[model samples]
Target chain A: MIVIELSERQLKIIEIVKENEPITSEQIAQFLKVTRATLRPDLAILTMSGMLDARPKVGYLYSGNNTVSIISEHVKRTKVSEIKSMPVVVDEQTTLYDALVSLFLEDVGSIYVLSHGYLAGVISRKDFLKNIMGGTDIHKMPVGLIMTRMPNIVTTYPHETALEAAIKIIEHEVDSLPVVEKFEEKGKEYFKVVGKVSKTNITRLFVELGRQK
Target chain B: MIVIELSERQLKIIEIVKENEPITSEQIAQFLKVTRATLRPDLAILTMSGMLDARPKVGYLYSGNNTVSIISEHVKRTKVSEIKSMPVVVDEQTTLYDALVSLFLEDVGSIYVLSHGYLAGVISRKDFLKNIMGGTDIHKMPVGLIMTRMPNIVTTYPHETALEAAIKIIEHEVDSLPVVEKFEEKGKEYFKVVGKVSKTNITRLFVELGRQK
Candidate 1:
């Protein structure tokens, strides 16, 4: 009946440990992009919470029970804001050719449609493929035409649990979900694009939970 | 001072457990696309290995120590040949524009250059951007002229450890390393493309290792 709330950095540290146990604090600090002193407090906290075990010379080891349940709870209780990746976005007026270049340059599978900082829609690889197959003028066509429009776009609030967002990805068969926040302006509800979640994020969660330290 | 050899299926099952503990055998079978009866032995083996704790209702719990060390060792001992993605390849005679289309279509950062099944060179995203920005005629240009030819291509053997391959990625500052096998023909050395290992692959390896019972 022990419930521990872990920070994102803590979760990342767990993944690092899972990948390289018996690893020294120096190595952990290097991976975390922090000083060893800065990581010391976090390490102490994890060890105290029984999520990690530290020895004089053995470095650290996993020694937790029901870690899966903890992970499941983490996915259920943690907010989307905590784990979402920076959303790749584009203006609605961007040309298809420019969008294509952006996609390749950014190394992203999809890009969010943002019009004046508002969530407008989403454009995916499939959308591009379908459009190209139809022989649309890539140089002249705007991305807004081919993007999956809002209301049809599946989105989650920043406060929602990651599990809920993850379920959306599976159910919709989409590679990512944009995390949004709604606001009222001129009696109209509009969503502000914030972040994103992908299969990679879920897999990373699983990797963190898999550790026993 | 303990060594454990885990099969790919076993590793996958561990991931499932980490994501959804208190999960039933039937559910695991469904996820694995196998019969419950077929999964029973694996469940039993895991439960007996001190890696899992099973109960009538609570299902399974993680119960292992030094799992990270074991995973690190797993990376060091396991051969790249056992876990590599199918190489994305193209012929040297292929046009640069066609190669560009293939790169985006395949969603790969780099492609292997093959000449009659022999590894000849490699073409990456940078190469495409450089050539395109230089105003080369994409329609008439062959990929061979722009490729990083043999003796410059970074490669790993199927027999090498994943850890070694990962190190190569860091050292060479490449997104992936092509797995190849060397052979001699008519007093000349040649390489045959087999597989590939990218950051995604290494991350996947870490995820698999993070799992407990």
Candidate 2:
């Protein structure tokens, strides 16, 4: 994809077209005080970019589609697998205290809880804090007790676009998402935690995109 | 800015220029079996976007800078004030338990602590979790005792770019930043918290950019 900053003359041409629809190219050239040959390339760029509509035996009309759709195309092309980070996981039997320890050690916002080596639930700092505030015995209670159980939890896969993952996070009001791989056994569906995509990952990608040359 | 997907002919023209440096327009047209008139707009686009360089009496040369710098430009132009959300602020004397209550009520990741109507400290869920794990008296201890203090807190202004704020969050490993306005009192610098910018904001902006038309 090629992104070009429209030249002054081209912007002017667009303004002129917006004011005078169905105007011929010769008329535009006359308004701009330039030769038809000189305006050919500018007209080509405007028409090709879908900012203007050129009709045979008629004239040019403003298409009113001059915004950046290409930017979205670039963002959607990035897949989840390319930017996911290592997930912090603990078994369902682990104590809430132990899970909190893992959270601090890993410096992550949330932890994935596993039961029989498959994702059962997810816990986060907020959950631990609320349980602590409620005076729950962290040492005796397993993380699975207070965790947000699966099937209700939002998830993303390797092949999905990062844009899709980000959308899920925002719409669901969650800080992180577990990137999982699905499995089927005895007519039951299960997901294995593979990676994690959080607001941190999306923010990092935004910074990277901003710094791209 | 106008973003366009380059036509097949324009891309072909670039490939030919890359292979043959200082190639004339006439030579390129010959390679593509098209007249110079047909190739004029393609060459204009290639050269104007800085993907190919043209020199007087020297023809066109591959500039090797075909990547999306425009995307970064677009991102940097967005200011922090345009996207900042209402900050969750509490007095330094407020109990940690009360502060946590405010956090839950506002549904914010961090809370800004104010002293004499100016920013004095900042606290996040991780900080509260850590203190709780260490057995701090949330109901008795004031938030000032454990909050990250001012001058150490990273901040952004209304005029600063969102890109700068995102960079600070990544580098400092903080969840959020207080959008502050500076004050001077008796040669002492003070900051009043006006808003908040977090990874959530950056992620939202990313989604918006992706959804831009």
Candidate 1's displacement at residue A67, Å, is 15
Q: Candidate 2 DockQ category?
A: medium
Residue B155, model 1: Cα distance from true site in angstroms: 3.1
TM-score of 1: 0.49
The i-RMS of every model, in angstroms, reads 14.0, 1.9
Assess each prediction's global lDDT (C-alpha) against the native.
0.72, 0.91
How large a fraction of the reference contact set does each model reproduce?
A: 0.00, 0.74
Question: Which tens-of-lDDT digit does each residue in B1-213 have in candidate 2?
Answer: 677788888888889999999899999989999999999999988888889999999999999986666473567689999989999999989999999999998889899999999999999999999998898999999999999997899999999999999999999999999999999989999999899999999999988888776
Model 1 lDDT at residue A186: 97
Residue B41 lDDT (model 1): 51
Off by over 4 Å in 2: A19-22, A70-73, B18-22, B70-73
Residue-level lDDT tens digits of model 1 in B33-149: 998766665665466445667888777766642133222233346578876988889999998878878877887768899988999999876566556545677779999999999
Residues A36-147 of candidate 2 have per-residue lDDT tens digits of 9999999999998899999998999999886656473567688999999999999988999999999999999999998988889999888898898899999999998899
Output the number of the lDDT-best candidate. 2
